[model samples]
Target: MNIGIDIEEIKRFQKLLKDKNFIELVFSRDEIEYCSSKKKNAVQHFAVRFAGKEAVWKAINKSKKLVITDISFKNSVLGKPEVYIKGKKASYIDISFSHNKTTVVAVAVSSK
Candidate 1:
């Protein structure tokens, strides 16, 4: 198994969100919708998901650059985090996220 983790400041993402290109380039449509759904806490949600995609990118250990939008997420019926790659559920990957008022963190373990 391979593991990767990432942490980011929520305020940084709050600033980045002002750029529409950044949002479209990094987040999938579903991700945008889901995060936007949070409304007031949208920045926190986006930051956490950004860290999650970065963790997944590192866990895969790919030398080539990854298309960030290709990595997205959803919540299971039970509210567990689920990773999706290229629009399909990636069963080989397990991911988790956490955040506070100022920061967000994510971890990914790949069993590929």
Candidate 2:
């Protein structure tokens, strides 16, 4: 098992969201749609997801670089986020995110 955590300021995503190509490159199509549907905190939403994916990637790979789009996230029925990795092992990865006005934090734990 392994664990990883990451944090980012909400404002950091504001710039990343600007480039259409970057958005496509970094986020899954559903994630892009979900964030776009938000009336407020759209950038923050994407940013938090990004942090969650990054944390999971760091936990699993340790050395290999990760492509953001390779990691996916979705909210459970209870509104908790879950992580799903593309073309990866069947291992389970649990992820959580929390945020305030200025920042967001995420943690991921992987179990084999």
| Cα TM-score per model | 0.93, 0.88
lDDT of 2 by residue, 1-112 (tens): 8898999998878887989998898888878898898869798899899888888887888755567678988776798777767844334888889889899999988874
Model 1 — which ten-residue stretch has the worst lDDT?
61-70
lDDT of 1 by residue, 39-112 (tens): 99999999999999999989985743667777899999998889998899998999999999999999999997
lDDT of each: 0.91, 0.82
TM-score of 1: 0.93
lDDT of 1: 0.91
Model 2 RMSD in Å is 2.2
Worst 10 residues of 2 by lDDT: 82-91
